[model samples]
Target: MIGAGAAGLATAIFTGRSSPHLKVLLLDGARRPGAKILISGGGRCNVTNSSVSERDFWGGRSTIVRHVLSGLPVAETVAFFGEVGVPLHEEPGGKLFPDSNRARDVLEALLREVERVHAHLLTAHRVVGISGARGGFTVDTLQGSIAARAVVLAAGGQSLPRTGSDGAGVQLAQRLGHTIVETTPALAPLRIGRADGSFHERLSGVAHDADLTVWADRQVLIRLRGSLLWTHFGVSGPLALNASRHWARAALEGRAPRMTVSFCPGLRFDDADARLVAAARERPRAAAPTVLAAWLPASVAAALASEIGLPDVALAQVPRDDRRRLSHALVEWPLAVEDTRGYNYAEATAGGVTLGEIDPSTMESRVCPGLFLVGEVLDVDGRIGGYNFQWAWASARAAARGLATTL
Candidate 1:
């Protein structure tokens, strides 16, 4: 194992336990293992999801993902973690976290399993290169070089560089004759270009449930519904993070993607228009901002009302055309996204080693025999909540099974 992250650690645990006669060595550049796990889910460590499927991921051979995941499904992951002493509890959206509500506990459980199998864990041993092929492989590290029959590359992606995934694995794979997909920051907060007078500047720190959609070249790319948070830069929160992938990819391709927030999610234009008309009729004395406040946050209502030029006017006093305009603005508030926060703040990277080079059933490299690639090191990223971690678990298990069989 060339990394000790979620995938690497799991691979070590499974490989060691399954093939006790074989020697297993897990190496990491970090001083401690599971650095990402320690900070995941705000320290709660979302280990897996209650329901996982190939559709949840982006940028990979979907067939390979499906094959690997089916081999070790989410149910099996839940049971495996439980058996390892990390009881799980499910939250909204099928997200599963440790019952203890501490990421340390989850890390400890994985470490315990690694110890149980007597796998050699060498922290601070950064792998510089790998030479040789198939049955005889030499892994070069800062400390020294070690020989191995097989090598597993789970060094992860460039999303959280501080967490020890600094694109080293991608570089290593590239050196070994693998095609790497262009990587970009995904699940990161977007940076909206400031208008002369941007409402987001004043609305910073405001959060509310909203529907977000990405549009590029006049075509809708994706739609998501979740909490949308306004920051001084642009937008953050679940909805914005989920939609960032589309926007980032489009931006990278030189196609500027426009993001529109629908404050009144699930409401048709006619329905939203009707609601405004009814509000005008029922609460004739109510101010437009006040009427909007009934459905939206006070800051959001004020911002929308100001943007629509009806900040203080009475609801009934507004003309029919202005009412229609207000309805449109309320439902489809346009935002100018300049760029993303980049990989430093991204939750996961959007691209990695292309999946075509790896065998779906075993996660072994077709280009380099005896070499396996798993986790975010491959072009497999999942949406927020616990899907990415589930990928880590499933892919690691698949690679372990393959390694055991080959041995």
Candidate 2:
């Protein structure tokens, strides 16, 4: 085993337990294991998703996720943890967390299980090279070379480098003759360097609920509605981050994507326009700030007004063009994309080992026998909310089950 992150840990755990007699050596570059798990979900460690289904995954064979997850279902995952003494609680968004409400609890549970199963976890052992063929594999590391019957790359994605997913495993896969999809940041904050630049700089602490969408060349690309936070550089939170994956990928292909956010998504455009018109009519003497205050945050509304060239215009005496601008602002506020913040800011990376290279049932590389890829290392990225963890669990299980023939 190489890279003792979530997928690596889970893979080792399952493989070790499935065959207690087999000696499994788990190698990780980090000093402590499960660093990502420790900080995931703001320390709550969203272990899995109740909404886990094939449909949640992005950019891969949808059926593959179904097949793998079917073999190691979420219920079984919950049960596995339950047996290991970690009681889980489900949040409103189908997100599962430990009853202790601490990320360390989830990490500790997995660590305890690994220990119980007698899996030898070698931490701080950075693997420099993986050699040998098929059932004979030797991993050269910082400490020393350790030979294994099989090699599983669960090194995770480049996102969260502090967690030890530093794109090293991708290089290993590439050297092993696997086709790697162009990797870029996904589930990251969308940055607007100009136009909304000042607002971006000052709106760091502001958060609002809205529907955000991204478009490329007048074509709608991604749409998500959820809580979004305005930051010093750009937008974060659910809607922005979810839409960001598509935007990041699209931008990488040389097509600059445009972000369109509906501040009032629940309201129809016509209804919103009429409401604005009515607000002006009812309060002919109403201040512009007062009229729009009800619809948006004071700073956000003021910024919108300025962006649409209506900053000085009175609400009651608002000109036709200004009203139209306000309507447009409310409907689809445009933010140009320069580039994504990259994996450092990403919750996940969108591209990896192409799904076609591996058998969905086994997660084994068709390109190389005894070589398995799991978690974000593969082209299987999911939307936010425990979907990535589900991928880790499912893909890890698939790899372990496939290795059962040898173990």
Candidate 3:
């Protein structure tokens, strides 16, 4: 067993219950296991997404996820935790967490299960090398080398390197003849304005619930709904991160993707135009910014007014052209991407080992026997909420089962 994160921990729990005589050993590089779990969901730790479907997951082998996840159902995973004494509460959008609303509770629950099953947990220990063939394998760690019949790589992704996942596992997998997808920051923040950009320093810290869209080379990409955060550096939050994968894809192909925010989600252009005309009639004497401020943040309203060349004129005196322009800007606020925040701030890695290289049914490397890859280390990543946790649970369960059976 490798790693002690959601995937690794869940694997231990299941494996411990499945075959107590297997002598499962979970090795983690972190001194404190579940560091990511501690800070997940702003410290609450979203456990799993309730609205899980095959469409929710995207990657080279998305179809593979459906089959893999079906084998280890979400209901069973939730029930497994429940049977272990951890009550769960679900938030809007099907995100689940411990009833206590503390990530530490989730960690403690898993830790208690590991202890109960007598699973050996060695923290602050790093595996430096692995060598062997056939049914026997040797895992060389900082402390010492241990012999095992199988090994599972659940060290997670390069994102949140502070949590102890720094891509060491990638190099190790490569040595074993597996191809690793060029890893990049997946669901990370997008850098919008610089000190010189028009929107620079204008709306930092201002948040608004809006529909975000990303496009590259005239192709519509990701679209999602969430609150966006304007920072001194750029734009962030769930919507921004969700669109980042598309941005990264565009950049990799030498094309920069631009983003647009729709404050009026699901509204047709004609409807938005009509709304603007009505606002102008009701507050004709008001400044264009003031008119817009009724529906948007004051800073955003002012910025949009400027972008549309409204000149801060009173709505009553504004020309029809200017009014039309303001309507366009309000409906579609365009933001150019200066760049992404890189892996340092990403919540998860987007790309990794291709799904074809691993057995989706068992999460074992089809390239190598007794070897498994799971978690963000693979190309599998979910939208914000608890989908990522679902991946962790499903992949870990499948891998652990394979390891137990093989050993």
Candidate 4:
């Protein structure tokens, strides 16, 4: 096994347990493995979601994702963790975290499982190259080189460079004659340009529930509803993260999709207008910002009032044009997305080795015999919850099964 990440660790454990007679080497470049796991989920380590589906992911084919995930279902994962002395508890959005609420516990349990299975895990053994095929293969690492029958590339993609994954695995796959799907930052924060007169700067540090949508070529790309946090650079949080993939892909295509946010989801323009009109009559003496604060943050309301040209006067004293403008702005405010924050801040990569190059049932490389690919190293990225971690687990299991049979 190559790379001692989440998928690599799981693969090593499963492979060692299945075929004990076969020698297994879990190699990683990091001085201490599982850095990503340690920092994941605000250090709690979201292992998996209680309910996961192909719909939660993007890239390759949904059928492939469905097949991989179904192999080792969420129930199996939860049960395995429980048996390994890391009982998990459910949180909102079906997120499963360790009962201890410590990522160290999760990593320690997995490492202990690897040791129990007698898998040799070597840290700082960065794999530099791989050559040969089928029964004979040589894995060249910075530390040394080893001969193996098969190699599994779970080195991950170019996200969180500090964690050790820096797209090295993707480059290795390309040299071995497999097509890459061209990677981009997924689940990243979008950087909004002030060209559109955006008030994002003024609304910084504010967070609220809102509906975000990406529009491209007069078509709705994606719509998401969740908390949005306004940062000085851009928007963060669940809603913005979910919509970022569409925006990034569209920008890559030069389409430059238009992004919009709705403070009141499902509120039409007419309805929003009427609501504001009624508010004018009811809270006539109230400040415009105070009235809008019913749906938005106080800072956001003030920023929107300033941006929409709503006068500083009382709600009822505002001009008709200003009132209607505020209503329209509240309904579907355009977000001037300039670019994504890129791999630096991205939670997962959008693309990598295309799924077509690997068998969905086994995660074995179709282009290169005796080669397997798994996890974020492939063209698969899920939404911000625990879906991505679930993918890592499922894909690793599939690859391990293939290795057990082949070895």
Candidate 5:
């Protein structure tokens, strides 16, 4: 094992338990294991999803994800964690977290499992190079060189460099004749450039529930509905984070994707227009912002009203053109995203080693015998929530089973 993260630790635990006669060694560059796990889910590790499917992942082939997930489904993951003494509880959107609500608890459970299986864990051992053939392999680390019959690369992706995943695995795979897909930051905040009289600058720190859509070359790529947060430089939150992958990919291809957010996701354009008109009649003396505040946040309503030049105008005194403009702004507010916050702020990486080069059932490399690629090192990334962690668990299990067979 070339990492000691969620995937690498799981692989070491399973491989050690399943094949006790064979020794399993887990190496990490960091001083401690599961550095990313400690910070995940706002310090409450989202261990897995209550429900999981290949559709939840982006990049690579869905069939590959399906095969790996089938080997260790979500239910099995839950049961496995329970056996490890980390009982899980489900939250909204089927996200499962340790009942203790501390990421340290999850990591502690994994470390306990590793110790139980008698797996050797070496921290501060960075793999500098790997050279091997079919029968034997030599892994060169900063500490020293170790020989093994098989090797599993679970070093993860380029996201969260502070956690030790700094794209070294991708470079290693490339040297061993594997194709690496162009990687980009996914599940990160989208940066909004200064537009003429930018409302985002004035509305920084505001959050609201909205429907977000991604458009590339006038074509709608995807739609997400969730909380949208405005920052001084960009937009973030569930909706923006979910849509970041599509936007980043489009930008990488030289296509500028536009993000359109609808403040009232449940209301149609005509319905919103009618509602504004009805509110004007019902609260004739009220300002337009006040009427909008009934459904939206007061700050948001004020910002939108100010954007349309009707910040303090009475609802009844508003012109028909201004009413239509306000309705349109609420329904289809578009923002030209400058770029994402990049890998430093990204939760996961979108691309990795191409799925076609690996056997889906075992996660073994077709290009190199006895070499397995698992977790975020492969071209598999899931949405926010517990899906990515579930991928880590499922892929690790699949790789462990395959490693056992080789042993």
Candidate 6:
């Protein structure tokens, strides 16, 4: 196994533990493994979600994703963690975190499991290149070289390069004859230009529930509803991060994509207008800002009323056109998103090795025999809330089973 990160660790552990007679050597370029894991979920380490399915992911074929995940479902994953001494507890959105609430505990437990299975993990063995065909393969690393019967590439994607997953695995796969989908930032914060009138900048540090939608040209591409945090840079919460992949992928494909947010999550323009109308009727003496504050923050309501030229008007005194405009702004507010924070801040990568080239049932390369691809290196990325971690575990299990069959 090359790259002893999340998927690499899981794959090595499953392979070694299941087949004790086989010698397992997991190599990682980093001096210390699991940097990403350690930093994930705000250092709590969301191990997996209580609920997961192929529909929770994007990229490649859904059928392929479903097949791989079926090998070890979320139930099995929870059970596996329990078997390794890491009990999980559920949080909002079904995210499961370690009972100890420490990422180090998760990593240490995996490392202990790897040792218990007698798998030899060598750190700092950066694989520079791989040569030779299936029956016999030679992996060249910065530290040294090793001969192996089969190789699993789990070096991860180009997110958080300092964590040691700097797209090296993608390059290695290309040399071995594999089609790579163009990769881009998936769960990354969006950088907003002054195009949106700098309202977001002024609202920095404010968080609220919202529905974010990305449009490709004029078509609605995708939508996600979650907590949105207004950062000094722009938006950095779950809603913006989860919707980033659609924007990044659309931009990479040369399409103009626009992002809009509905502060009233499930309300449409008509619904918001009716709501405002009802509020105005019910409280005729209330000032516009005061009435708007019923649905938004006082600061936001005051700001919006001031920006829309209804700052001092009473709710009933406001014109119908002006009220409708405010409703539109509340429901379909367009954001001038310039670009995302990129891989440096991305939690996962959008595109990777095409799934068509690999057998979904086993994650074995159809182009190159004995070459297994797993984890973020493949064309699979999930929304925030532990979906990507689930992918890592499930795909690793599939690849380990594949290795068992072939080697």
lDDT of each: 0.89, 0.83, 0.81, 0.90, 0.89, 0.91
Error of 3 at 143 (Å): 2.6
Tens digits of per-residue lDDT for model 3, 1-407: 77898888888877888878888899998899899889999899988877787777666677887877887777887897787787887888789988889888888888999889888899998888877753788988899998887888888888989889888877777788888777778789887754337573677788888888778787777777888888777888777888787788777777667788887776656787788788878887888778778888888888877766786678878888777776676667787777889888888887787788988877888887888888877878788888888889888888777877677
**Which digits, one per residue and each the tens of the lDDT, describe model 1 over residues 1-407?**
99999999999988887888889999999999788899999899988888788998888878888988898887888899889998899999888999999999989989999999999999999999998888999999999999999999999999879888999999999999999989998889998886625888889999999999898888888888999999888899988888998998887787768888899998877999999999999999998889989899999888888877873679898888888888888778888888888899998998889999998888899999999999999998899988889889888988988898887
Model 5, 11-90: lDDT tens digits are 99888888888889998998987989999999999888888999989999898889888999788999998999999999
Off by over 4 Å in 5: 196-198
Best by TM-score: 6
For model 5, what is the C-alpha lDDT against the true structure?
0.89
Clash count for each candidate, listed in order shown: 0, 0, 1, 0, 0, 0
* Collision pairs in model 2: none
What is the model-wide C-alpha lDDT for candidate 3?
0.81
Q: Which prediction has more favorable TM-score, 1 or 4? A: 1
- TM-scores of the candidates are 0.97, 0.94, 0.94, 0.96, 0.96, 0.98
lDDT, candidate 4, 53-119, per-residue tens: 9999999999999999999999999998999999999999899999999999999999999999999
Candidate 4: clashing residue pairs, number = 0
Model 1 lDDT, full chain set: 0.89
Best by lDDT: 6
Global lDDT for candidate 4? 0.90
- The count of backbone overlaps in candidate 3 is 1
lDDT of 1 at 177: 93
- Model 2 TM-score relative to the real fold: 0.94
| Candidate 4 wrong stretches, greater than 4 Å | 196-198
Instruction: In angstroms, give how far residue 179 of model 4 lies from its true place.
Output: 0.8
Provide the clash count, candidate 5. 0
**Candidate 6 TM-score, true structure as reference:** 0.98
Pairs with backbone N, CA or C atoms under 3 Å apart (clashes), candidate 5: none
